[model samples]
Target: MTRDKNKKKPPAVQQEKLNPRELNTEENKHSNHPLLDTASAEIKKYLHDLIEEFKDVLLIQVRQDIKKLIKEMTSPAQENTDGRTEEIRKEREASEEEFKHNLEYMKQIQREYQETQNSIEYWQNALTETKDNLLKLEERFRAYERERKSLLKITRNQKEAILKLEDDKKIHNLRIKNVSEEAGTSKNEIQKIFTEILKQNFPRIAKRNDIQIKEAYRTPATYNQNRSTPRHIIIEIPEIHQKNRILKAARERMQVTYNGKSIKITADLSTQTLKSRREWGEIFQVLKEKNMQPKFIYPSKLSLKINEEIRYFQDKEELWEFVATNPTLQRALKDITEKERKRYQDYSYSGREASVNGADHGMRE
Candidate 1:
């Protein structure tokens, strides 16, 4: 390793210079390659010959391309291919200029088309947004209408229920007929008269001190006028047991006289209910004749035991139809029809005939 490190170096020999002529003398304006002159000269000669061989062919092809471009730009025309050499050259030059002008025109047309397309897109987007909004509004309006209809139905049902409850309260009231109304008589006067009538007719009930009168009033004079008129008064009793006893006794006895007048006691009903019962007058008579004991049940239902099976009627027409089919009902109905006809005739002769035009609805409760 010490011998290697101390090794003396010999003097280096110089490289011989080359003659430029031996390198095949040639040079370009850039003067890049020296030894590559021969290959470059051959490449240049080959390219020159290739160009010379295809010069007319290239020029003809270019001229045809320019003429074709012009033909595409303009309307259909006759071609003048067989022309003088000078005329063809001049036509080609004019064609080139026209092609340049058409290219510029096409570029301008492309820009205008792009602008039109952008405007159309903007309006389309706005119209789509508006359509969506309108659809949403329509949906909301339909929902609101549905909700309104639902609310109206609920409100109508609630009103009917309230009216039914009001009518039900009339069940506790009692009406006294042929109880004369005195002139300038107030509630106290009417009560005194009512108490005396009750005491005379229903003795056992009147003696009970526990039975309290909630209200007492004289009937409206118009209702008890003209057809063997009975002056009426209304009484409200709170005790169900006492009221039932009085009502039951009155129904059984069928007649009560007070102050030399034939007084009758009856249940006080709502106007609608009384009208409904009055319509069943003939039906009630039929039921009575048949010993059916048809009664006004809760909510104004007509109930009776038919062949041991309890049947109910809400409509008079249904009762009439049922009677039409049953022999017993048919016979009973005939009697009532004859009675109505006879009553109608008597009224025709009397000239002061009383006809029920509307329902009598006044009650104490």
Candidate 2:
């Protein structure tokens, strides 16, 4: 291979002008292009350097473009991250404000609950006190009721005893009505007049001593010259039988004269006994009309003859009970029974009201 070192190459052929990239081909090397085979060493070295410099310049340009593209892509992501951070800060502030508001509302609710509890406790205590007071009042009312009933029983018994005493005092007394009252008339003169009148009517030869007059006087009243009515003469006898005899004799005679005037003689009775007797008037008249032979048995009792037997009634209530057993009597006395029932109810109601008022007065005392 060294033997042809100085040998002459083929003649250079005239070709189209080409760049180094076109000249550096496998076809040119295989074809033994005259410029490639016989080119000067300096020329080859210059072409190699030019190609290496071009590659270097291209690599630098590529690196600059890639860096610019990456910067462009990452700038928008960074801006988005900053915007998201600002939104997170605003959301945190809003959540904190809502929490504060809820806390304030919860505190207010707690305060209201405490106030309600206090009110409930106060009402409970008041209710307890009210219940205690009511119980006390009930007990006091019951005690007053018992005391009132006991007082009513005692009062009724005392009144009955007083009435009995009054009636007993008048047992031997008589009243003569329509007797002329003369001024300056003495008790002895009145007694003598009564004796004369009794003797003239009875014809028993009763002397002044036989009459047994204990005392005699006109009813106490102021004497007036212009007064037309005369006061009655009240006489007290020593014995009850003597008084009864005079009453019987007076009843037997239709008219008794004293100083040419007819007078009425009746038994002197207590005011209470007289009132009770008057209350029996209507019943007495009805019984007499029916031929029941009813007679007053002193102090408001009645003796009735029925079925040939004698029956006694102590009060209208007892008579009502007996009449209820007899349909005919009940029918006949229906209106009277109703009237009496209404009267009794009114009396009972008034009595209760009086008792209550008296009890209240006693309590105050």
Candidate 2, 230-317: lDDT as tens digits: 8878899988888888888788887877767888998887887778778777778778777888887755568888777888875554
How high is each candidate's TM-score?
0.43, 0.50
Clashes of each: 0, 0
Q: What is the clash tally of candidate 1?
A: 0
**Tell me, what's the RMSD of every candidate?**
25.8, 11.8
Best by lDDT: 2
**C-alpha local distance difference test of each model:** 0.66, 0.75
lDDT of 1 at 121: 99
In model 1, the runs with Cα more than 4 Å from the true position are: 1-163, 221-231, 320-365
Write candidate 1's Cα lDDT for 1-365 as tens digits.
45446544432324235356643343333257543555567667767766775677789899999988988765343333334556889989999999999999999999999999999999999999999999987875565445444544454456446646766686677887776554224677777776777688778767875667888776674544464654567778887667777878988878887876788887777776677678677777678778887887754668876667677876554465476687765665676666665654564334221211111111111
TM-score of decoy 1: 0.43
Alpha carbon lDDT at 61, candidate 1: 92
Lowest lDDT sum, 10 consecutive residues, model 2, at 1-10
Give the Å error, residue 177, model 2.
0.6
